[model samples]
Target: MKFVTFSHKKAGHHHHAGVLDGEQVACLTEAGLAASVLEIVQGAKSALDKIRGGLTQAPRYALADVTLEAPIRPGKVLCSGINYKGHAEENPNAKMPTEPFFFAKLPSSVVGPDVPVEKPVRSEQMDYEVEFTAVIGKPLHKASEFDVMAAIFGYTLLNDISARDVQFKDSQITIGKNFAGFAPIGPCIVTADELTRPDDVALKTRLNGKLLQNGSTSDWLFSLPRLISFLSHYVPLEPGDLVSTGTPAGVGAFQKPQIFMKAGDVVEIEAAGIGVLRTPIVAG
Candidate 1:
């Protein structure tokens, strides 16, 4: 099942949890099943069973009648860095890490599909990275790889928008990656049972209709189990916490002449089976 958080056009600005069935969405809130995606995540299997059994009776809305929001408001947006071999190889300065190199993007930075991401006046080299993100379903601390697999709730996509100038000048990554609207996530979260091949999913990024980054999870240097387990040992992940696997190559800063997003440009990121997450660039 594809789970979503959305606001109906005629229903004011309130957000609701929903299940998507092609072009139609069954409103879980309207059906009295769940109030938010975080509730469903924490409830685990019982909540899922309820959503599946009562789907037919839920209020339905057309895709065009509502706006999609990030699937969940996670407590932490944990991200892996240089986990893709191609991405590591592309950057002359990057040394392949023996362990998962992780970072955090503020939850406030998150926006939904079709939202506009601001090109902050402080940056000149804005870039795009499409990552496959996992949503944790249960708690984990010093977990085994096998346990990590069982703890996954679903999969979603995240665009790691960065400000290269700020990143390099400040000599840090967090501030550059945490601008407002920088972490655009979701069209919907495809439940783990629905995405059987999470390790081999394909990913792509297009800047203004031109395909720039084309790679797959098959190229990942660290597998999902390896990454999650490593993180759990220190972070003590909880339900609704996100684990965003890093991107493959083709970021703008590495290009020969360099390329950066400006106002009016749209960036579309696609993760096979999960659907496209589109973000428009706007002046800060």
Candidate 2:
């Protein structure tokens, strides 16, 4: 089932966990199944079971009558950097890492579909990267790869917006990728059970109607299970923590003339099985 966090147009301030059914939404919160998407993740299987059982009776709304929000505000936004061989190959100076290399994007940086990603005026080199992000369903620490595979709840899309100037200036990438609207995460989360062959999903990114990045998880240098297990060895991953697999090769910085998003540009990130996550660009 596709899970979402949404708010009715008439009551825009309140967001609720929901199950999307075609052009309609089954409101889990109204049915008392969940308070928020984070709560559903925390509750894990039990919450999902409740949602399934109560779905038929839950309050419903037309998909167009509600506004979608980031599926969940994860406690941690752990991102893999250069985990794609093609992506690493694009940078003459970047060599593939033998082990997973990670970075953190502040959770507050996350925004939902159609929101505007502000291009900070302080930097002129803003870029976009579409990452296949996984959401943790169970807590894990120093777990084996098998355990990591079982712990995955689902998958979603994350646009790793970056300020290239700031990122290249510092050895650390956190600040460059943590601007308030930098991480646009979801339209919905496609539960793991519904997707097969997580490693083979196709990913694409388009900027202002031009397809700039197109690749697949098959190019990953580090697989999802390995990436998650590697992270779990150092930090405990909670149910709502996000582990974003790295982007593919076509980022603007690696382009011949280089491409940076300017005001009024729209970018879309699409992951097969999941939907497109679109964000508009505006000056900060």
Candidate 3:
């Protein structure tokens, strides 16, 4: 069953089960279901059973009449860099790290679909990275491949927007990835069971209706299982933790002329089964 965090036109806010062919949303509380998406994820089997039962009797609000929020309140956001072969090749001088290169984005950077991607006035070279993000369902420490596979709750589309000028100027990438609204995380999270093969989905990015980056998860140099196993070896991963798998090669910085985002541009990131995340670029 699909789940969401939404605010009805009349009611202030709450979590709900997305239903009725995507036209309606049923409040989990009113339906006597789990209180939050985290609760559902923690008790997925029982929660799903309850949501399904509620579908038969709970009243639902029109989808158009509610505002949607990020499906999960991530405890931490981990992002991989140059994890795609082609993407690594795009910058010949930069050697691929022997281990998975990772960075963190503050949870405050996340925004839902349709939210504006505020352009920080301090930077002019903002760019986008389209990637698939994994949402963790269970706490894992030094997890094995099997444990990692079992711990995945779902997948979602992620736009790793970067402030290139600041990114390169500093030795670290944190400055580039941590700007407010830099992380556009969701249209909605697609549960693992809903996907045929979560690790093989196709992903792409578009700028103002023009396709820019097009690639598949099959191109990942470090697969999800490896990433999870490797990361858990260092730090523990908790429920709702997010790991963005990395982007393909067509980023603006790699273009011959180098194209960066400007005000009023719409950026869209899409991954098969995970849905699309669209946001407008505007002055900060």
Report the number of the highest-TM-score candidate.
1
Candidate 3 per-residue C-alpha lDDT over 1-284 given as tens digits, one digit per residue, 9 for 90 to 100: 55677767566554554533367777775666766777777775666677777676766788788877777778899998889898999976679878887889899998888888788998999999997988888888999887787888888878899999899885648988889998888777777888758668888898999998999889889878899889998879998889988888899998888989999999998988766788899988
TM-scores, all candidates, are 0.98, 0.98, 0.94
lDDT of 2 by residue, 1-284 (tens): 89999998655558889998889989888888899988888888888888888889998999988889999999999999998999999998897698998999998899999998888987899999999999999999999998887899999999999999999896648889888899999989988999877899999999999999999999999999899999999989999999999999999999999999999999999999888999999978
Alpha carbon lDDT of residue 245, candidate 1? 96
Write down the worst ten-residue block by lDDT for model 1.
8-17
Candidate 1 vs candidate 3: the TM-score winner is: 1
Candidate 1 similarity to native, TM-score:
0.98
Which stretches of model 3 miss by more than 4 angstroms? Answer: 13-20
Cα error, residue 89 of model 1, in Å, equals 0.6
> Mind sharing the TM-score for model 2?
0.98
User: CA shift at 136, candidate 2, in angstroms?
Assistant: 0.4
The CA lDDT of each predicted structure is 0.93, 0.91, 0.82
Q: What is candidate 1's lDDT per residue for 1-284, written digit by digit as tens?
A: 99999998655668999998999989999899999999999999999999889988999999888999998999999999999999999999999899999999999999999998889998889999999999999999999999988899999999999999988885779999999999999999999999988889999999999999999999999999999999999899999999999999999998777989999999999999999999999989
